[model samples]
Target: MPIGDRDLDGIIDVENSRLLSTYRKFGVVAVKGKGSYLWDAGGRRFLDFMGGYGVAIVGHSRREVIDAIEDQAERLIICHNTLYNPTRAKFLEELFKVVPRNMSAAYMANSGAEAIEAAIKIAVKATGRSLFVAAKGSYHGKTIGALSLTWGPRYKEHFSKLLLDVHFVEYGDPKSLEDAPLEDAAAIFLEPVQGEAGVRIPTREFMTSAERRCRKAGCLLVIDEIQSGLGRTGRMWAHEHWGISPDVMTIGKGIAGGIPMGVTVVSSDYADVLRLGEHTSTFGGNPLASAAAAAVLRVIEEEDLARNAERMGHRFSRGLEGLEGRFRIPREHRGLGLMAALDMRLRIQEVIPRMISNGLISTYSGLRTLRFLPPLIVDEDDIDTSISILDTTFGAIEREKRSM
Candidate 1:
């Protein structure tokens, strides 16, 4: 049946009934998006700071990305890895230019989880080892293999038996990583910036020490950049900020301009470990995703979105910090580039809906942290508007508290 023929409310009801209750719904039925804003089914406009969990870096419905997708769809959409296509080849060449210089081979997949899964498989194949090390508060992906390396008890408690031999170390502590047993490890997975754990930024010393220890132990260092990569942190890759290189890197989210695409990039030394028949995906590196990815790279370079992310990030962070003084509230502001968080003194559950009601959209990390991931295309005006809405919401909440 045509989508237009179906009643929106009825469709939602059917979805709720048929689909597994895995995701927590937010009530807003987002129908469209462009640049830095979203429009709900009722035509209510919202300033989108959530960016679909960091997938809209280049902005929603960008013309270049949309054009590429449309043009590729006209010719071909899916061509299995069994055959080589021009768009896919060009995408690989463009992709390598932005990633670490040493990264030579890339295995494409459909999501961040698949990218982490590929990284795990390649690391294991290269080192012939089974154990892995990951940082506390790090989120890799939800798939069993990737979940094994992810460091959240809430996510792992139900699927404990499916996890692999993985050890957790304190983030931003060089001593912890240096002391971890890595002799028999295949790889140590780390996020350049822990995203789900409230946009935690690690110290330079910790990252450098981890790299050195990984080298010393001859273990593959896999950096998961699914949320922190592709200009989200004002750099092509977040690890670039610390001048550290990983043996393998998993990247996704915004890599293909919202198209479902993930990549595990491996250095030349370990690229051949995953033999031709050993690792493959049916829909990986297809023409449509490749075309979209290539266009995104071009736009990022042409528009210099990375530098914009840096400039705007500073402005936004400073604006958020100002709130603490104005409201006399205890808060902490932490971020790198555009990926930032505001840890409010009060619970965030009450503020999120209020912000939305006032025409702003954001997300929460943990219980009290409000995370902001606005599109790279966001301007000074957009930032200011979001901050204003936040200020009004905070003031209203405070007034209510005092009245009570």
Candidate 2:
């Protein structure tokens, strides 16, 4: 509103009046962010546990990211896919080092959904199959190929007619996958940590067995690390902890330090499957996005955010467990590293608005899980502050129930 310098009062009012109501936005209009805090138009500060939906792994408005964006903006922004871009090439070269050895090449996309599409294309092309097998309660993305693999009845009921054939077996069970006749299947998609399905952590045995079975059956293995990637879970990539490397992997959300970027890395064997003109994106490998992504990776590496996340995550998990003793409503606390979720008896209908009113925000994996995804750079004091806010809010709800 005022040269993007903390004046959102007038901007939000005008936006509400004219823009479409797709998202149920919070009342406060955030103007700026740095480290793990954000300020609204009224200069109200919020300890950003959300982190742009787990996008700001290295923290908000990081100097490195800002510098990269500025440098790229001055140089060149967008160009067609027909020509090569310097930043994009550099980003890919850096990306290849962190990925599994099997994954040799990558395709850049503008968002997670596009990466999902690319993964789907690679998997299908590799195996020459049309059917996909996924787990129930897994969220790949909102695009057609991704949504096809998603297994929520409520979300898919309206779009049933528009979906494709995706067989979903129970999550955290490898027998279902092993027993299946998968000769005609393209890939078996799994999210190492089921972010939307309540941060469900599966056993390493389950994942390893699933990978073995998929490989044995000649079906490509695709892991969606969109929400769980880039040190959110104490690892460069979430799949690394499982000891199973996917033939193809999708990464986004935190790839570019809150800037927009998505990636689909594939093994060299399957990488060449996608023809020159088969799939392409206009903004997929833009200098601005790739430059930001490179900066994000550099920050995560230089700061050793992965190790920090592991240490802080254990501390936070223990703290949460202590709180659970007092509250006793949430059924479980689970996740890896900084990515954690609580299985709450309180449904989303009641808990969401309550948390928001208390000057805090949380996420729901299903109707039950209250997800806690603090930034990787979030300090111990901020963790304490967030827990205090939640404890106060939960106590109020308990008091109201007692009165009722």
Name the top lDDT candidate.
Answer: 1
Residue pair clashes in candidate 1? none
Cα error, candidate 2, residue 401 (Å): 2.6
Q: Over the stretch 203-302, how does candidate 2's per-residue lDDT look in tens digits?
A: 8988898788887889988899999888888988888898997888999898988778889988877878998789988888889989999988888888
Instruction: Write one digit per residue (lDDT tens) for candidate 1, span 118-197.
Output: 99998888888999999999898889998898887988898998889998999999999878998889999999999999
Model 1 RMSD, rounded to 1 decimal: 1.5
lDDT, candidate 1, equals: 0.90
Q: List runs of model 1 lying over 4 Å from the truth.
A: 1-8, 328-330
- Per-candidate alpha-carbon RMSD to the true structure: 1.5, 2.2
**Which residue window of length 10 is worst by lDDT in model 2?**
1-10
TM-score, candidate number 2? 0.94
Question: Each prediction's Cα lDDT score?
Answer: 0.90, 0.83
Q: Tell me the RMSD of model 2 versus the true structure.
A: 2.2
